[model samples]
Target: MKISAIHLYAIHLPLHVPFVVSYHSYDYMPSVIVKVETDEGIVGYGEAVADEHVTGESWEGVYQILKNTLAPVVMGKNPMEIEKLHDHMNKTIYGAPTAKAAIDIACFDIMGKKLQQPVYQLIGGRYHDEFPITHVLSIAEPEEMAVEAAAMVEQGYCSFKMKVGTNVSLDVKRIQAVRSKVGEEIAIRVDVNQGWKNSATALTALKQLQDCNLDWVEQPVVADDIDGMVEIKAKSVFPLMIDEGLKGPREMLEIIQKRAADKVNIKLMKCGGIYPAVKLAHQAELAGLECQIGSMVESSIGSAAGFHVAFSKKAITSVELTGPLKFSKDVGNLHYDVPFIRLTDKPGLGVDVNDEMMRELTVFHESVYLKEENV
Candidate 1:
């Protein structure tokens, strides 16, 4: 089928509670939604996170790129030629990677619907039916975090991912407090979110944390500091998980060759989408480096997509698609695997977005972006 028209808009889905991380606090997720209309009148939806801090992309910028640059190139082209369309869009701007990413995912979803197969089929053909325990806890005091940790254990969450990066000493104290309370049976992991003080401070913290049995420490330094990460990985006994520093499989390869990071975190937003995510997972498997499939505070739509990626590979060690729990209400009717994250058997990502809920809950809204079809 050929493309008919493209519509780009912003959907502001409110979170049930404020999502606090090391760098920012978010009470609602402001995502740029791309709805592509094909000549057959089939509509496919995709979401791109408007993360100014992580991707340097805003909702307006992502929406404009999808409407003006990407929409024009894809029109009239065969909808099945996703790669050619991806290349055409990529050539327009080497800069707007994240914006390109949102549009790319929508196109793939459209293609999947046309084929009557799930997106996972095109993304390495579903390896596991379900993923392991994926959970996100609030950033509380050492005592409070420990209490939450104990509660999570009771709830059947095996892996506990903590948000750190406040300071070297305090971050250490927080991990230790959880370890003391949980008594080391539960797997403890920390994500600093690019809050590293320096190589020296990271090394100091690593030396003290060797006994904490951390699953991995994420983005101990900035995304740009590849050499610093390599040096830190060399001295530390625990694995160094790279998040912000990576772009895709190619970047992951570079880090592996340089030993810059012992592991890598693959979030759909950062890697563009499942097409590249599967490629990265298979490549990581070939290289023997573990992969961590995480999230960027995505809604059920984005979280379900991440779950499919996690279930696609055995190389994935820990899963973190906990965006649904952070929200007061899930805007979609998707069911994830209990105690872990898993999408239903329903088809094509297997989630239903609630229209009425979105109508009243939408905290932000924007006009439908349209481009000249003949342009």
Candidate 2:
């Protein structure tokens, strides 16, 4: 079926607690949701979250590009032609992956619905019925972080992702405290979020953290420092994971060729959407590099899209799709059993959106019909 109309909504969902990464802090998650309408009366949904520091995009920017630039390109086109639509969108604009991802995800939802299949099946079928999900501990005082880790452990979480990089000594204390509180059984991974200004500082921190038995260290240095990534990877015992540095297959290839990292964190927002994220997973698989599916603190919609990719690819050994858990509420229904997450058998994303709730959360709205000259 041909795409007939497109609708956009800019929403701000309050976080249960403040989410602090090295680059920014958020008490609320700003996201742009897209609804794609087809001639056959089928409708599909998608969501995009833009972090100016991470994806070089803001929610406002994503909304504008999806409405004024990208929508016209996909108007009246087949939603199932995701690859071709991506080609057209790339030619139309550069580096608006977050905006493009919204459309791409919506199209995948449409395809899954039309075929009466789950999105994971559409990708490559599910390799995992339920995979372990990590509970993310935002940057906080060492004791507070440790308490949170202990609480999650009591609730059945076996893994934790700790946000770090603001202060080396404080960070070391944070991990050590959490490890001490949770004991040696829980797996702990740290994401620096490019907070370590350079390789030397990162290496120093990694040195102190070496005895903690970290599952992996993510983005210890800046995004573009391929040489720094290699240096840190070679010097540190912790497995290095590249996050912000990887956006597409080209960067993945570079990371592979240079042996820059032991793992790659694939976020649908960063890599565009499932269409390209699947490609990233395949490339990582072939290169013998493991993958971790990360998140942008998204709602169930965006989180589910990432979950499908993670479930389909065996190379994706680690998952941090805990965005929905951080939010008080979300548009879509994604069930969480602490360390494990599950989606329904419903077609498309399997996670259903709460339209009434979305309306309450919307800050900006727009709709583009095929008859409009904007197309």
Candidate 3:
């Protein structure tokens, strides 16, 4: 069936606590939710949580692109033609992956519902029913960070991703305290968010961190610094994972060719949703590199999308869909057992959206419908 209408909601969902990375601090998540309705009355949900520093998209920009640019191209088309629509959208605009992600995810949802299967099954089938989720510690004082890590560990979280990029010495101290508090069994990964500034600084920090026994280090240098990544990878003791540096398959190929990183972090928003995310994961798999399905701090809609991709690929060794845990309130429900997330066999995303919560959280709204002539 053809798509009949598309609705957009711009929301500012308050974070449970301030989340600070290197480039910015997030007090709340400003995101766009997309609802795609078809002539057969099936509806699909999607989310877009963009960071101007990361994905180069703001909430307003994503909302505008969804309403003015993407909706027009997909309004009367078949939602099942997701890949073809992706081609059309790429031709229509450039570098709005976050915007395209909203539509791409919605279409995937529609496709799954129509086929009476879950998204993971439609993609590559599920490898596991549940996956471990990583708890991220925002940049904080050494003692405070250690306390938070201990608390999550006590609650059954076995994996942790620490945000450290403010200062080299302080960052080192923070990681050490957490490692000391949690002991050795818990896995710890560090994400600098390109806070180290340059290759030399990153090399120096890596030297100091060699003793921490980190599981991996992510984005030590800037996003565009491929040469710097190669240099740091050559010297750093910890395995390096590229995050902001990777946007799509082209960048993935470059990273593989240059031997820039040991792993790549795939976020649905950065790679234009599951359609391309699956391809990127396959590319990394072929190159003998591991993958981590990271997040954009989205609600259940986006987190479920990432989860599906992570479950579908063997190359994706790490999963970090913890956005639903950080939000004070969410529009959809994702069952979380502290460190692990489970999925149901329900069609599409297997998420139950709360209409009332969605309405309460929305700050802006719009609906686009196909014209009669187009139909």
TM-scores vs. true structure, each candidate:
0.92, 0.98, 0.99
Alpha-carbon runs more than 4 Å astray in model 1: 363-375
Q: Candidate 3: lDDT over CA atoms?
A: 0.91
Candidate 1: minimum summed lDDT over ten consecutive residues — where? 366-375
| Stretches of candidate 3 exceeding 4 Å from the true structure | none
C-alpha positional error of residue 46 in candidate 1 after TM-score superposition, expressed in Å:
0.5
Q: Tens-digit lDDT track for model 3 on 229-330?
A: 999988878899999999998899899999999999999999899999999999999999999999889999999988888888888888898889999999
Tens digits of per-residue lDDT for model 1, 1-375: 767666555667678767777888887877766666677766666777767767677867877777767777777666677677767777877656667666666666677677777777767777776766656655667888889888888888787888888778888888999889887667878888888657787888889888889888888887888888988988988888988888776788788789787788987788777666777888888888898887877777777777777776889877788777777765676565568555555566666667676666554454332246442
Q: Give the per-residue lDDT of model 2 (tens digit) for 247-321.
A: 998899999999999999999999899999999999999999999898988898998899889888889887888
lDDT (Cα atoms) of all candidates against the true structure: 0.74, 0.90, 0.91
Local error of candidate 3 at residue 19 (angstroms): 1.0
Q: What is the Cα-based lDDT of residue 373 in candidate 3? A: 91
Q: What C-alpha RMSD separates each model from the true structure? A: 2.3, 1.3, 0.8
What C-alpha lDDT does candidate 2 achieve relative to the native structure? 0.90
lDDT value, candidate 1, whole model? 0.74
Q: Would you list the clashing residue pairs of candidate 2?
A: none
